[model samples]
Target: VAAPARRGRALTAAVVVAALVLFAVGGGAGFALTRALAGASLLPPPSAGAPSLPAITDEAPARVTTASAATANGEQGAEFTIEVGADWTSFLEQRANRGLAPSTVVHLVAPTGGYEVSVQRFADYYPRHSVEDYLSLVRSRWPKGQYFGEATDVTDPLDPAAPEPPVQFSYRTVEKATELGRAADAGGRDLRRSRYSRVLPRGADLWVVEVVFPTEQEEMGRSRLFDTIAGTFAVVG
Candidate 1:
């Protein structure tokens, strides 16, 4: 009877061990199956390295289009005409000076509110001032801590032989604290501005044509829209 009881106890212990082994094997197989169904893997992950990024390339030139004629007349009977996009609206305003000649400003607002071209005509204090001289003054008046690119001479495509070519320069600014920036923020848009300016002598007065637009729309500013304004601008008194 004692031998029989020992055999029974050994058999019971063996059955318990077999059951645990089966449960572990089944559980591991179930976990692997679940991972496979969920698009995961039990294998090691790929080694870390630099992230893949898109290649950079130069942007293609924008298409040229013929602009429509537009004119702005100031209160002092001075007027200027330029070619602008058909969708633009022109507003003329006279700015009075304390003891100097009054100036005229023509704001050409773009359709979508992100771009504007302003034409300003003011008395040239220095009658002999060159484009470079005017540009130096303009640079001095710019707000500090802004990024300004080199000024370049842009020949008038319509009048290539003109003696004084327009001086063109660009600058960038973040307008998060301004009124325009506040409106942009409400609309979930960034208000970082990219501005392009051309300064040239227009008879006794100086003409400064500036284009301001969102930085994301830089290609539009670089298009023939600017070319038409700078090349076809004419002023008369």
Candidate 2:
């Protein structure tokens, strides 16, 4: 059986800003209280009679939509909006991928569990080249994964006008996950690498947008949540 996939990238400092948005209303007081509690002695364990925290499950998908502004300029530049589960919130604590253009990024977090997803845009340095070329460049940086499978177009179900476009594909790769600082998990990260990418054509300019998510859905053998979120991805002018 194929091993489960894991998250590959680190959360960038800029992305961390999103995580604080919800907490910003509480101000520094909430942060100060958390720190104070952490410094104090360990609290006693809860009694057996105490209620336990609810288990994290992927059986049902959450309904939440968050819109991000269009990055590429001009009449043909692509713009998009995505919806994540309501249980998931903004995950600001993500590391920046220096290779990508820091135009716009949306990170989502599973409040009840440790799952995250992100959408980011990268400038198309080789506007003259084909979309395949860009996909190859991005894959090259991911040296760890053993990629397998041919690229297939991810078409727009809502728009029949955009037919058989090679802007998206079915990408798969397997790689060791980053567990501890150095210890690598035996499970793979192919599912994580199953991100959806597209090149936005803005006149002569090109921009790439990527939607990334944890393999949590796959881990639970559930796909509804992932599919639900992915359904909202769009590249528009």
Candidate 3:
């Protein structure tokens, strides 16, 4: 009887040890899984407030420089003079960098004062075409509803004996956003006025003097200024 009791007791002790080992293994696996899942949840997501990249619109403005007439009129054979307004240096500047041919002797711009003046020289390549024909070609390029006034004869002090006086044509055009859109719907009144004079001296290279304004409300001011300048314009040769 004592021997059987000893054997039963050993079997019961082995069963309890085996149960404890299985329980410990299962608990360790569960603990490890819980840590992995919780670690993922606690980790922060990617941030959205990082610094923005630089863009093209952030570039600096153009550098402004003074222009001297002596430098502008220094072109080889197209030297000429133009009258400038009083206090002109405060209001206007010559566009030294404007894309013009070497024959384009002078170009002036005044954004605040609202005008642009340019003097260009061209060879008499179109001697067959009359001034009227040339002016018609220019007017044909205007948009619809733009006004093109009649061409007027300009008195050429340099050439009084020519058959017809040099021609001057004036025109007014409104800036069109598109072919179908109305000017009012586009924005404020952006009226444009242009004066083009074909200077025909007896034995001089053909020249064109142009003045333009963004708005016609100040037409008188610009007209007077341009007339003053054109009256004084003289050819070097």
Q: lDDT of all the models against the reference?
A: 0.60, 0.49, 0.52
- Pairs that clash in candidate 3: none
Candidate 1, 62-138: lDDT as tens digits: 22232222224233424556666665677777766444445566788765666678877666433555566655655
Question: In model 3, what lDDT does residue 140 have?
Answer: 66
**Candidate 2 residue 67 C-alpha distance from true site, Å:** 3.4
Give the residue spans of candidate 1 off by over 4 A: 1-77, 95-102, 124-128, 157-165, 178-190
Predicted structure 2: clash tally: 10
Q: How high is each candidate's TM-score?
A: 0.53, 0.47, 0.49
Give candidate 2's error at residue 105 in angstroms.
2.6
Q: How many backbone clashes does candidate 1 have?
A: 0
Superpose all Cα atoms of candidate 2 onto the true structure and report the RMSD in Å to 1 decimal: 23.1
Best by the lDDT measure: 1
Descending-TM-score candidate ranking: 1, 3, 2
Q: For model 2, how does the per-residue alpha-carbon lDDT over 1-237 read when each residue is reduced to its tens digit?
A: 233222222345445766777568576667667867889534555544312333445555666454443344452343456666666776432223444333455677667544445665443334445555556666675556366553656544433432223355545555554532333343223234355455544333344444443433343312444445556666554
Kindly list the per-residue Cα lDDT of model 3 for residues 35-111, writing each as its tens digit. Answer: 78777543456554422322211122322233322324454444555655433332222322212222333566553
Ten contiguous residues minimizing lDDT sum, candidate 1: 62-71
Model 2 off-target regions past 4 Å?
1-61, 69-79, 91-103, 112-115, 122-129, 144-150, 157-166, 173-193, 196-222, 234-237
Please give the RMSD of candidate 1 to the true structure.
Answer: 9.8
